[model samples]
Target: MSSLKKDVCNPYFSHIYIEKDVLKHPVTKKILSLFPNAQSLVINHYKDIFCRKNQNFSLQKQTPGLILARKHDNLVYEGAPVCQNFGNQHFYYTSSVMNCIYDCEYCYLKGMYPSANIVIFVNLEEIFKEVKGILARHPVYLCVSYDTDLLALEQVLGYTKEWIRFTAEHRDLTIEIRTKSANKKVLDEVRPDKNVVFAWTLSPEKITVDFEKHTPAFEERLSCIQAAVKKGFQVRLCFDPLIYCRDWKEQYRNMFQRVFSCIRADEIKDVSLGVFRIPQDYLKRMRKQAPASAVLQFPYENDKGVYHYHKDLTEEMISFSYELVRKKLPMEKIFLWEKTKEEK
Candidate 1:
């Protein structure tokens, strides 16, 4: 039996509550020890922390810890990117966990939060109920694992597994778990649901190695996606925030070829393309955090509060990449996320 199947039997975590009851399980106690100063926030069925604002790189690198907070059952949009993309359609997203384990330099988390502590919202059932209510009105697409990679922390939190079970029961609901984790253990334990899409944000090998610090290698991520496809999971490809690199076209062409070669076209559900863009405030914070990073120093055009590549260059990249990917995937299966004029 896997360690996950074994009942959480630990004593140090006796003060932690799952729903309302304080859990004395040994494993839970061990996990709690990682954050000794955290306060238990119990809001309705969910319990987590109300973390302090400005948790950017400077604060997190000093004392990396976890925050415990309960998410309000009524609220859905948890983090940044709140107004863009699906936010317009009233599509809901809830983060049971906050602060990712990986340390990608391009990640907005560096600018968004002042700390690196992982915040876990314990009241999951209430969130599920809220989701059910939302889905009753119209077919909903929910993006899970956005703020954090749920699969990487699956052994510690089991929230991803619970989500799998929840989405499996609700066919009207579409759940997308976007991740960079290469953990295959979590995938093996849970069967795939047709309504759930396991989306992986992929980059070129050079970019993955150089820019995405501490993340899984490009090949490893591809292998994980391949495994998920074999398990009957609907997989989506995201070549988002395409980094501008030397020999950029060749790099992207090789990446697309490598991706299609590993996974069949029929197994893929869809592909989303978006060039790198960040809010002005976040970019300022990120620049302060890493003064030497070329990614931060690159000349960017500020459209409103967000910063992105120049319009002409960004559009060209998007068009070229989308065209290349479309050759491998059907037109209906391709989704392009670019900034429109009104968005500027």
Candidate 2:
């Protein structure tokens, strides 16, 4: 392991809960070796701890524990309506890990999951089998880093490389791995694959520092994006969930100039834009956990079951970003998230 990996493996978890069935699994064993000092406890299933009622999600987030288990069913899911399909007919996502290491105040995981602790499924073959079954029918655009940032945890988990290798074998399978990680070591070690798209989420420096706790600074993430583009990787830029603030326009304007300055917009595969929105239930849970958070506490309008900024504000943000990106790339390459007429 590299010095950076060795250092990160030590501090994240003090206790690890392993499923009895996967205690002997290679992935589980390898993960255990990285944190020899952490106490290990065997459990029947991940949900025994992860789904427990009254788990202080906020408190556990401060120093979350780890759960290693085997996922037997529902390994892959149809992409949610809120997610951008990018014009793919058969879009799906799988979660090898659940809950994120970085705690963004606007993150829906806080409300979608009962616990803040991280869960890493040790069985990749099962997930691969499920994907293969789906691919047998038709082409697939799979988002591997759906629920978690796989590249950020690459040092400890090494699943990102495995997904890339798997994609290389299956011509019909195209995967998108989204991340805010600044870990350039991953890009350096892994070979680039055209079938695999590396999507980096970019936020203005002010919003990143204020709401995205424990994440790499904006400059660091920008540097990683540059490295990926230079290495022949299919890169996609995501400016989604555009947070609303008095100075949002200025921040996003400066961010666009800074990004296109370093990496040519034509070099990337595409760019995605969406305003910050969440399920109504999720916003309720998040508000409870972080009552003082301006991001969470804002009085957003309810459109059906989702909470979002008013329609006018949403349009202003997306349109502003679209025009800026249109200056650099053709209209075909820019994607915007809009509700269907039925949905509206």
Candidate 3:
């Protein structure tokens, strides 16, 4: 059952949905070449097929369709407040893809989008040009994988490799590709660049099994991080959206012990920690989309516009993580929401 689960768990892109206009484009052709067996469906626009009503996100994830489309406008967006800017003056994020392959119970994408399918913008060069123009004025920090996990889809998409080359040319440009994937081979393919940070999102094994569905387990994610770091990549570990599970303190404490034991503390760029949070409206929509989800059903406190663990729980989680991280890594290397309570 476990072996079979591994084979069936990963989302398979069995159908290719291509925008009619990009049918002749080289990227579309190359992507189609990768999946020659996938049935091709031509459409006028991606959202037309991707944003359809009554589509089951979970069901579609089993046999997901790939949408190759052209992004018309808003090539880049200012980074959201919820995300850590890492002290960048001009931070931005671009969604070359719409959705993720893995199905995490607490993921906001389920609420933010109407489809379970993955959308890849074939026009990668255009987004780069937009960044180049933005760079003409100021140094820019971009999070390219905010909307989707680029590492997980690297085999077919290879957008991260393209971004690596793009960053190589633009000295002023810095990008962060965040993922929960532990695909070691994909991580090794790209040349590690300080300008391009590979941030791994890590969770305790218990939370991983319960909240993060279809994801690489905690140990796998740690090994992936060690491999990247050994390969000379600036690795950032994110304990973000910290889950409040059974014996939460002990869970996180043991997880941290296992984490620093295998990976060198001094080599890590930084560690980010935060309690569970979702846009108030997104959580509302997620509850509607996944009514059975206990993670979303938790009665959270609304602070301004976002829904999150109440102040007390929020502080406890972040403070506990901060203390644990500081013990092994430098205090400066610790990054979090900066709860009112500080740990020494």
- Each candidate structure's TM-score, on Cα atoms with residue i matched to residue i, is 0.82, 0.95, 0.93
RMSD (CA, Å), candidate 3 to true, equals 3.0
lDDT of 1 by residue, 1-344 (tens): 01222243322222333434324444345566664754544333322322455444543433345544456645466334522243225456788787787777788877776666666666677788888887887777788788888887887787788888998898887788888889888888988888777889999999998788668999999999999999988898889878887678899999999999888889988888888888899899889878878888799999888898888888778877988998889887776663532332
Please write out the lDDT profile of model 2 over residues 1-344, one tens digit for every residue.
01234344446678999999999999999999999999999999999999999888877777789999999899999999999999999999999999999989899999999998899999999999999999999999999998999999999999999999899899999999999999999888888888999999999999999889889999999999999999999999999879988899999999999999999976899999888989999999999988888999998999989998888887778878888989998988888885722233
Best by lDDT: 2
Compare the candidates by TM-score and give the number of the best one: 2
* Model 2's TM-score against the true structure: 0.95
Q: Give Cα distance to truth, residue 53, candidate 1, Å.
A: 7.1
Quote the positional error of residue 127 for candidate 2 in Å: 0.2
Q: When superposed on Cα atoms, how far off is each prediction in RMSD?
A: 7.0, 4.2, 3.0
lDDT of 3 by residue, 1-344 (tens): 01235366544777889999899988899899998788899999998989898887766766678999999889999988888888788999999999998888899998788888999999999999999999999999999999899988888888889999999999999999999999899666778888989899988899999888789999889888889989889899998879887688999999999999988886788888888888988898788876777788998999888898888788777878888888899877877764333321
lDDT for each of the candidates? 0.73, 0.91, 0.86
Candidate order, lDDT descending: 2, 3, 1
Name the better of 1 and 3 by TM-score: 3
